[model samples]
Target: MKNIKLYQVFLALLGLIAILLTISLFIPEEGIRVFGMNLKFPTIGRLMHPKKQETAEIDNIIVDVDTTFADPLLQHQNGSNGDMGAPNAGELSVKNSTIIHLNDAGLVNLHNFFEKLSSAATAKKKVHILHYGDSQIEGDRMTGFIRERLQNQFGGNGPGLVPANNVYNTFAFVQTYSPNFKRYTCFGGDKLNSRKYGVMGSAARFTREYKDSAEIANETSIKTGWIELAASGSAFGRSRSFSTVKMYYNSCIKPCAINVYENGALIHQDSLKADGKSHIFKLTFPGTPGKLKFEFSTAISPTISNFTLEGDYGVQMSNIGMRGSSGTIFGSMDRGVVAEAMNDLGVELIIMQYGGNSVPFFKDSASVRNYASYFKGQLNSLKSMRPSAAIVVIGPSDMSRMVDGIYETYPFLPYCVEQMKKVSMEAGAGYWDLYGAMGGKNSMPAWVNKGLAGNDYIHFSNGGARVAAQLFYDALIAEYVKWSGKGE
Candidate 1:
């Protein structure tokens, strides 16, 4: 009886739909009025065919962002170089996205930093800007674009700082090494016991770690290690043209003679000081040397802090990509060594990209606030190390995780962003809302579907990174314009 009733009810619904279709077909375009308002019905032709609703594209979904920044492509075409190319970093038109919040002191610091950039060439000192981030920036994805644009526009050259035995295979520069080289990092599982990881927060060694002077004196044979370097085939023009090479090391007990060879023949030779303090050795080539090889002969290897390729003046921006960090490790490092390294490099700006690594462990709003507070402490520590440097903290980009069988934005992420910005402002640092700029909550799904982000929905693709970086660049240029009273 129940089955019969369900079938009858289904038939009645079908009959009702048919009746409505026939009535709609018979009804005129101006239907019979039932009240003061006129009624309308679909015509036979209209009833037969219906229009479809179109889905909006990625740009269409971007809401509440200031889209006034000149289209990067079109802006590049207006370059004064006569030939069509992109303008320099500071040459963009109109304000970009709005900064979440920055206190008055932070604005003053930014202005001071801009002064440094503008007068760096006149002063004959290069402004070193350290971009610290997680794996998203590893291998020079987003930072590469920023570096290229800044170097071309501002006065920087060379890929900022390439590790001696690079762990990440970055295309901006190429380096190959002998098998004996070992690496240790403060951020990794195989960290140094001394906790003396310098400004780069990592070190590379060609031989065993130095323990005592006796070990170096009793050495039987000189340890030989080598690294061959060549600019990659697709390297950016600015990154490839470097005239200076600076080697940083510390805790040396044995004098190491380093030979710089071009192809088969040695072009230069220098010896490392057997001192127990940090030191930087600089060598300037007559021109951009070709296919250089650095051969080391040392009985006791010092910690190889960093190897930097740079020009004579302007800016030097280094990407310090730590794989899994919450932006809270600065206080744990040897403060004197880090400060000396920054001073040596003339660091004036520190752009810290973090909060992504901390988002996964955020169980609630309190956790988010706590992490932000902890991050503020690290920022304070960094400021102490580089007292004159201005800091900018870029909050995490949109990240999604599988939640209840559907990929969705992680909960408390906005809270995390809120707390981060609050603390950064309190710490007198500028904060960029990467999450908001990329589109807010659940935007990762759209970015992933549009090929702007990877399948993991946590990282941006190369194309997306370019967009992200451009947004940031525009923000900086816009504020800089406001500060300088130019670029109207």
Candidate 2:
């Protein structure tokens, strides 16, 4: 009797397992939601979905992105220009049609800003360009190259902005900080209760809140926040030196002492005001310095927003690269802080490169459209803060996903790029097709094969970043050349 009952129980367990396997086979591969709640079924769905490719060979796949893909706007041109004498301000290139696509409305409005950048060196003025992007630019990959090239062409020095408590070990500049500093960003992790993340969508502090002066004095805690910046030996000569260093900080309740050291020698010591308003501390070196360090000693840690190292004149391109951001957090940051930073830096142009982070999560057409609309709002917010700053939106680059053990371009990447271009144009911003520049569909696999991209088929390697940056710089120069002719 006991043996018979044991056999029945074993059979029941097997039956339950079989039922679960059957349910897994029917679950959505892309995931599903009922009444706005995610079904959390991807783990189960993977048991059956994305059927593994049998005898798949990556080399067998032939990818010719340039031949098959062209920007949608190319068709709309309709041979509008009767005579293509010299490429006009917003004319499509007759050779490749990869030049910056200027919305007629935006070009007319931003004509002066472009002219200002073109004349920055001659005018002996500091023109700032904020290149904001997602993980594609993490560690200043694309932006650093662009900065090096532009500074070599125009006139500038030093890596523009270095964030406090940097998550990515950047090659643009060598930065070391104490481990006590906590990183707070608008997008992820343990965010601050105040939500006062700066323009970079992040800030770092030694403590989360204000501490009583007596308590701080009595406290023997060794927790302190400090950062050091020196020229990375590998960086270009132009970016390896700086004439000025400006630190941006806020949210200090008690006066805190800040120490500045130059080449390990104490240069200056000062105390910050207890006032909670944004503040800028400027230190001008006698000439381009090789190294500088900042040590903050306070019981209550103030939010150290960012630091800018720049030259006396020429174009200053700040690489405000935020990892894993969708470029949508600008709306949530403190507008006052953003406005102050924009005006102080005199940002004349804003180049936003995003959408690669949004590729995998897009479920359908509605998702793409919604993302476009959402991104447009962020652009509008930036415009409102810096009305004089001309905006250029670089659409998503080609990204890949493995399906059936074969890596191919995401099915809707091209669609997402087109929608982004439309909304950017509608929002009175110029659009650049990074996707097309990279050779379009399935180009990531090609880039990976060439060692220009990572094995993940997402982010670019250093060489790939240089290539992308050059393409963008070339497109930008093409427009500037036409604008420069007018000045001549």
Candidate 3:
């Protein structure tokens, strides 16, 4: 009886194992779903939605008219005879046409801004455009493209912003370093404060301390005629400490003293000092337009904050990227300092690209609205400071969320975009529908599948970024044309 019982138990156990294997085989690779409605697995259910197309229509009016105006004639063919041969005649006519169009209007407006920027360049006027964004610009990809395009169109030169040392490894065009000094950026929490300067606005303290050698050198060559030093904070000391630092320029020559060069010609030279305060230094070199360079070495290691160089009249794109920033820290920065910087740079446009970092934590419409309110306050503060700069707020892109055992659009993304748009308009800033531009709801799957966007979906790939930048630029151009009466 015992042997029989043992045999039956073994058979039961084997049968149970076979049943479990069968169930496993039937499960979906992503995961088993009760009704194919729960998207909880990555890369699955990405096809659940169809592509969305965002379109807008606007009417353009044109008119036709004929008119005549008087003109002074210097002389007539029959003056000596009796009648002058047909007194000098002048005529005027106007033509108008009505047209309807569909496009990313915002991008068209941006293109108009660039057109004006190009005109400024042609006239040899200094044009400054501030491109403030998040990590998308941290690598300088989008900004670089716009800068190159503008410069090529308008005759400007050089990379715009050069920090004392590059803290991020993502910068592809330029490299930076400071001897005998370790650098900490706001990106890593190694340094955090209310005065954190980022792609959006200026910061307060760019703290630095000298170790051992006590001297720092920034090695990037300036390819423009002007260099603007940007810094802030009263915490480093009052006036005396801030006023006592010296800047130099080093070449193959012996003078090695502080010298400013324009187009390879010497312009000015000065001596060194060791005061411990922060201030902006403006260096202008004279000659035919060309590249310039500034070398800094002080008795004490000075904290060099921000550097911008450009033509007299071309767009100046400045990126203040704070990694991990939720875009909620703008109100914390010293507004006075930031305003001053904006004014000095002649900043005409400001772009705020954020929201990705906050997407994961978004829960409901109320929470999103609260965040938008905070963003509005930040914009309001900026407007109060630099009342002249045009502001454009870029909403976050689509982020993936698991649903029905597969990845899909985050449930609240559309709500978030709507909230941001409302806040932006309320703050008197123009809002760019990045979400809409990306083709609306659950569009990331299509973008990634088409290889236009990255797999992450939240952030764009290089090609994706270029497309986004172009869209924004085009929108701006369209608006500018309408404002300037350049479009028929």
Candidate 4:
């Protein structure tokens, strides 16, 4: 009788295991809602196929940066003598800090943009560099450092293009917008059905989207909105001084009254054109104002794309940070609106830093390749939109995830990096291996321990961002110096 009871217990345990497996297989990552509460179970993907573990816990990490990739191309452009030849010992040493990979055509594109950046002051025109990335660059973290360095090296001033809503409120400037404004973005949140997100991938408006012309026609109540910009005490010296502000807007069927104020006194006022087309409203100041305010009143709010804070001449880098994006939304955006904005802004280079957000969910080699394919499409679209601008893709950095109580680099991260690099170069864009720059495998734990990165092991802290940005900037300048010397 006791033996029979033991056999029955074993059968019951097996049935329980089968039921749990079935439930786990059906459960998604976001979990399910049960009785107004989120109920979650161990996912079958994680339970069945566990992440591959590292050899051992990393104790001492030595970062070895490969510099050969920095000078990947030496094309004889514009009567330069160096054509696919070896760089000298001095040049190699100067480029030791960079891990940039560029092909022949990419190098040419870089050189052309370098020429424009170098002569911006002499030409009396601003050369814009649009820096687009995920949350890794939000609030102008790395972009701020890069901007300061670029402005100091080349001649430029101001904080570059800022969004109309001023959501991030970067350290470069203090901004505040009224409560009436509503923001629409291309990457996340409630996206616009019109797909008209401009260069910043976002726009602001006081009125909600109207379904038909009748709704817009019936809207007669006038709405008032305002945005204010103030100088930041902690801002870089160059960003603190700007002589001009250009507001980019579109889709206006009614005349909007705009008033610009410096401090408490009204400085300039104008009415927006009633035409429903893209336009730029320019405002120049004799000197830096203490507080700049822009107030608008209209029955229907027009789409405000962005506002430029720049000088008359020099390099201007715009920080466009889109959170939770893998940089794949450009193909869905309005190409014409983006191209128009790019042309108006005098864009010479576009720097795309992405792939971190996709690192965690990458399941296998095929998944990595699939993402790369989609990413390539986005790059191709940008290239088509702005053929004259140089494009560079900064691959994802070292991101870690917890597996069996130990935080280690994601299993497929290295392979994803490899695929992203291949796709970027194939798309006629330069590639920067951020993973290698961050010291490769199992590096995030050390960074987290040092407090350079967040405990999440994905995003970098402010200090770490500066370090990362410096690595990129150093590599860029080193390559430029080599190219400039070759031209001479």
Candidate 5:
């Protein structure tokens, strides 16, 4: 009986708690009300309500300038002896407003080249401009734009730069697909100790050895030009295999013979050279408009270093990029082989864009100076190999990092730029301040925020890359104009 009474008391308390909870749900807490219901506070409404609404006024007006001079004395006071403020300095001198023009140092020689090139073009001689740089020039962004402009002003046909193996194809507007051989690049570790074909060029050594009676079919058709075959020591031991080489135009016809169609008449059948030494082969026809097919079969496997099919006078630009290269790897390559290859290609200009990789590793100015000295020596060696080529040095662009939760320029950026400039001057090369052109220190924030540059603040976005390429091109063109006495 006692246990039953305890249980009943507990049940009574639970029922009372449930009733309290139900009442709490409906009651509003200070100024809170149920959804879609209005709370009327009669006491506050009568005290706060206004008797009438007030209105504000706005005025609009128009005014015109008076032609008649009212203050002759004031005008006389402002006049400066009829000098017109020293002739208004005549449009700020094209030199001051534009950053595109060459500095005083690079004007003389560059101008002479332009003049000679112009003269050669007028004479219908194929004048060539070789633009070589780092990864920036790889896909022909800068080179293509400059080529189009120059070719429009000058005269040229078709795109330059032969389709080479191991190309960054995605970035290229032109495409190349080859078979019978695999492609490798220095960027990959296939060749450990390779030769940098001199400033004029570099030799790319292949791991694939040539076989006797090896036939390689390049599936590309020549649409606009003739091809040339050249060899270098890069293919050191493979030269003896290729004694007889045959080129077939249209594989549908077997045992292809060289047909001479001069003036729409079959003049003669010239025997094509089966003996392959690195020499030029001019396949002449009746100038008929048709796609050219070439089939190369050799009795002996000929070792080829470089082959170029050139059409018209134009510039061929190539970019070789190594993410962390310090511009010191040239000495590690096969100098003789590289020199031979570069000479055959006729490389004229070399642009070295580096310095970012060296920043974090270098400590002080003395250390930088030592690196610069070493770099200068390397440049001297390159010059020795390719004596005729002109070299240009581009400094690193502005790079930034976070400081106390805010973005800021890298502490060592200025130092890096300064060291690079010193090295360039010592090496007898022209230097362009990429940082300055990028609006100098603290400019990275603006660039990244405005989407002009990448979030890394180092590499450029596509638009940024285009703008950067344009800047460099403009500078070159400006230098050309100033030197050639050609005004825009």
Candidate 6:
């Protein structure tokens, strides 16, 4: 009697399993309607046996291509460089939807930039390309590749325009600072009490905080804060060369002495002003130095605005990265100081790539449009500062959100991309669709599957970043090909 009862229970369970398998075969692949409620049906194999979740392994796919030689494509010509071929970045290239040129003028501003680029090697001054972005480029990911390619195509060297106190460990250059240097930013930090943050939207100070004279007296002994930079051997060839270094600072109310060392030998020394005004200290080397160090000794530390490393001539692509910025904090900075920096650097092109930070919080298309509207004002303000400079806006790449236990593209990413393109053209700036180039809807998952993106589904892994940068470079060159009448 017990054996008979057990056999009956086993038969019942097998019957139920057979029924589920039959139902799954007829249901839509996406899901099925059950009891008037949309439900996803599992595959027979999935129902029978579950697959384990696996994380993508971070691979060293980036080859660090030598960017020291000029690209044959960048050679100047009247038009028709034979068959204008598409750009190749080793593995991937831009296809189908190239960079969007919204207006009839298209990339006229950028075309003018190309004129300077063609003659960059012989230009009287170095032409700068300021690539401002958020954490996507915080460690100089996409921007570093873009810089490498451009410098290779044009004639340039060194990583341009680095923050004095970098929060991210960037491969472009290795920077280390003394602990006394306190970081402050215009975007988000404890109130700085001064709105003098420069174009980069941040500054660092070595002075100790004071509550009264007692605090100052207690720390009267002169303390020193130093920042040292050396060419990172892991970086690409061009990024490893630095012949010119410029330091921007302000708010020095006390005499501060600056000593610069090249390869551990004291090369230059100078004293800073006691007046509270913006100042620039330039140190140029006749040849590339293996390492460079700046040591400052003072009773009070001056606000160190920023630092720049560059070649004497050619295109200098500066990665002006802010960790959590949405490309909307430029207006909060000192306009005069920003203008000064722009002019002093001889900036001719500005590439503003953002929107990732705002993706998750965006409510709807209207919200995205509103954000773009505010962003338009910032672009206009930048134009006012550098009237001749061309601005290009790079839309955010595809970010994913977990839906029904699967990572899928955020619903409104395309809407945000369109809105940004519309406003960018309205502001007389060029636009690039990073999302579209990355394989439109539901593409982040594929990138992750290929080990090109991170497991977080938000940031691109090193391999993914290199691919995106290459696509962007290819798109830019394609537009230039058309603008220059090189391709029919």
Clashes of each: 1, 0, 47, 0, 9, 0
Q: Please say which candidate is ahead in lDDT: 2 or 4.
A: 4
Residue 54 miss distance in model 6 (angstroms): 18
What lDDT score is found at residue 382 in candidate 3? 74
TM-score of 3: 0.63
lDDT of 6 by residue, 213-249 (tens): 5665455567799998887877766777667788998
lDDT of 3 by residue, 140-185 (tens): 6566555544444344443455554455544322333324444444
- When 2 and 6 are scored with lDDT, the better candidate is 6
Tell me each candidate's TM-score.
0.81, 0.79, 0.63, 0.82, 0.57, 0.80
Give the per-residue lDDT digits (tens) of candidate 1, residues 1-488.
43568889899999999888887878877577787876776666665765332222457534433323332322222212222222245454555765535799898888889998777655666889999998888877778777776665666667788776688868678888888878888776667666667888888777766556586578857788887876665666667667788888887777788898887798888898887688987877655657888888887677778788877777788888899977788876889999999998899989999999989888888888889889999889989999899999999988888732467778889999989899898888999998888778877878887787999989988777877887887788778777778864
Clashes of 4: 0
lDDT of each prediction vs. the true structure?
Answer: 0.77, 0.76, 0.51, 0.80, 0.45, 0.77
Please write out the lDDT profile of model 5 over residues 1-488, one tens digit for every residue. 44568879899999997776555545444334559664533233333452232111111100111112122111112322221111101111122212422344444435545664555444543344555445434455445554444444444323333333334532322222235323333333444222322332322221233223322344222212122232222211111011111221111111223343332445445433434323333442221112233223322222223334332333334345544466766666556655554565455656677666665566677777777777777677777767666667777777766643456666777877777777666566667777777777776666666565777766666555655655665566566665556555
| Superposed Cα deviation of residue 119, candidate 6 (Å) | 2.0
| RMSD in order of candidates | 11.9, 10.3, 14.5, 9.4, 20.0, 8.0
Positional deviation of 234 in candidate 1, in angstroms?
2.6
Model 6, residue 144: displacement in angstroms? 1.3
- Write model 2 residue lDDT over 356-435, tens digit each, in one string: 99988998999999999999999999989989899999988888888656787888899999999999999899999998
Pick the winner on TM-score between candidates 1 and 3: 1
Model 6, global lDDT: 0.77
Best-matching candidate per lDDT: 4
Candidate 4: worst-modelled 10 consecutive residues by lDDT: 80-89
Q: State how far residue 33 of model 1 sits from its true place (Å).
A: 61
- Candidate 3 residue spans exceeding 4 A from truth: 1-119, 152-155, 169-172, 184-188, 192-278, 284-300, 403-405
lDDT of 1 at 92: 45
